[model samples]
Target: MYALYYTPGAASLVVHWLLLELDQPHELRAVDIAAREHKDASYLALNPNGVVPTLLVDGQPRYEAAALAMLLADRHGDGAFAPAPADPQRAEYLQWMFNLTATLQAPLRLWWYPGDLQCDDEAVRRGARARFEAACERLDAHLGAHGPYLLGERLSAADFYLTMLMRWSRNLPRPAHDRPHLGALARRMKARPSFAELYRREGLEEWA
Candidate 1:
């Protein structure tokens, strides 16, 4: 069984959702970021970065939401959530995964926590928002041309990651779901029974 340390509605949402999708038996250990429980020594030992989503994989701790999503999918998806190494779509699968993580997720972090830059917060947010929207537009166009899912018709780990990031934009000036194809993709993804379970488990009601 896996032990997942998570904070509701945070980056950990993708990992938690994947566990549900994979039908994996896992334990949820809530990390109260509001109370700084994540920064405590015990949690830090499990995840030195002091972040939500420290997943115990066979007794070893691993963090990073994107990495964890890919790891879980690769290990347990039976080629449904990810393409195998020799599959023709493997490269495309990896490209979308990295794009979602590095391009979309990175700037979103700044948008959420502009203080991390140690400068004018509004200015930082403006820059981050711009970067995020640009990436979103490209993704929206891609979905318009080639998707219901990032890997085309079939869902992959990247779709799970993208949906979680799209949820983060629920309150943005130009939310991700405002884009036609992205909105459609979000609708399809959220329709999955696993997504409803994820929202219920995480106690998230905003986008549900």
Candidate 2:
């Protein structure tokens, strides 16, 4: 059986959600971050970076959320998390997923480090916030243009990643859910039964 090394509340949430969506059987091993378990020598051998959400496949480790999502999608089927590579919408789907990881996630990170960016220096923090806010604005605009989901109207992994990031964004100096469309999208995702089940199983109180 596959064993997923994860923390209670981390990017592991995405992998956990994806695994549930795939209906795959796997073991959930929570690495206590508070105890520095992830930094242990044994854990380091499994994941050199000492990060959570490392999937142990056949006893081999596979990391990176985007890669894991794509791997799961491919392993599941053609029309599930991802469409066939030949499909026209595949480009847009992959684009949105990567955008969540690359564009959206960075700003969300800064919310946890406002002063570290030297927020006192208007230029530093302002520039960081601007960069982050711009991404949120672009995401908001994309959601408005696309409507219901990140890709047109079908629910996809992109939505999951976006929803996860938005959950983080809510605590930011600038929250994405402040936008009507973005807020609505998050509400829709949170209301889904599948998401609720995953939350319950993980004992996650709230998603957004």
Candidate 3:
């Protein structure tokens, strides 16, 4: 069984959702970020980064939300949530996964925690917001051209990651969902039964 260290609706949401989607047996360990519990020595031992979504895989601690998502889908999805390595779509699947994490999710960190740079928060937020929106526009166009899902008709772990990122944009000046294609993707993803179970477990209702 896996033990997942998480905060409700944080990066851990994707990991938790995947566990539910795959029907994996697991346990949740809530980290109180506001109380600084994630930074404690005990928690830090499991996750040096003090971030949510640190998963204990086979009793070994592992972190990084995207990595965990890909790992879980590959291991548990039985070819449903990830393409087989020999499949032609494998390359495209990896491409979207990396793009979502590196291109899209990276800017969101700065958008949410601009103070980390010790620069003018507003400047950081503006630049990050612009970068994020540009990525979203490109993704929207890609979906418009070739999607009902990122890899055409198949639902992959990357779509789950994208849906989480899109939800993060709910408060942005121009949310990612404002893009027609992305909005449709989000609606499709959120309509999954696992997503509702995720919300119920995570106690999240705002995005729903």
* Model 3 accuracy (lDDT, Cα): 0.94
Question: 107-187, model 3: which lDDT tens digit per residue?
Answer: 999999999899999999999999999999999999999998999899999999999999999999999999999999999
- Identify the leading candidate in terms of lDDT: 3
Model 3: pairs clashing at backbone N, Cα or C within 3 Å? none
TM-score of 2: 0.88
lDDT of each: 0.92, 0.78, 0.94
TM-scores for all predictions: 0.98, 0.88, 0.99
What does candidate 2's lDDT look like per residue over 16-135, in tens digits?
888888888899998998899999999899889887779987778998777777778767755777867898888998888887887777655655556666566556556656777888
Task: State the lDDT at 118 in candidate 3.
Answer: 100
Stretches of candidate 3 exceeding 4 Å from the true structure: none
Tens-place lDDT digits, model 1, residues 15-50: 999999999999999999999999999999999999
Every model: Cα RMSD to truth: 0.8, 2.5, 0.7
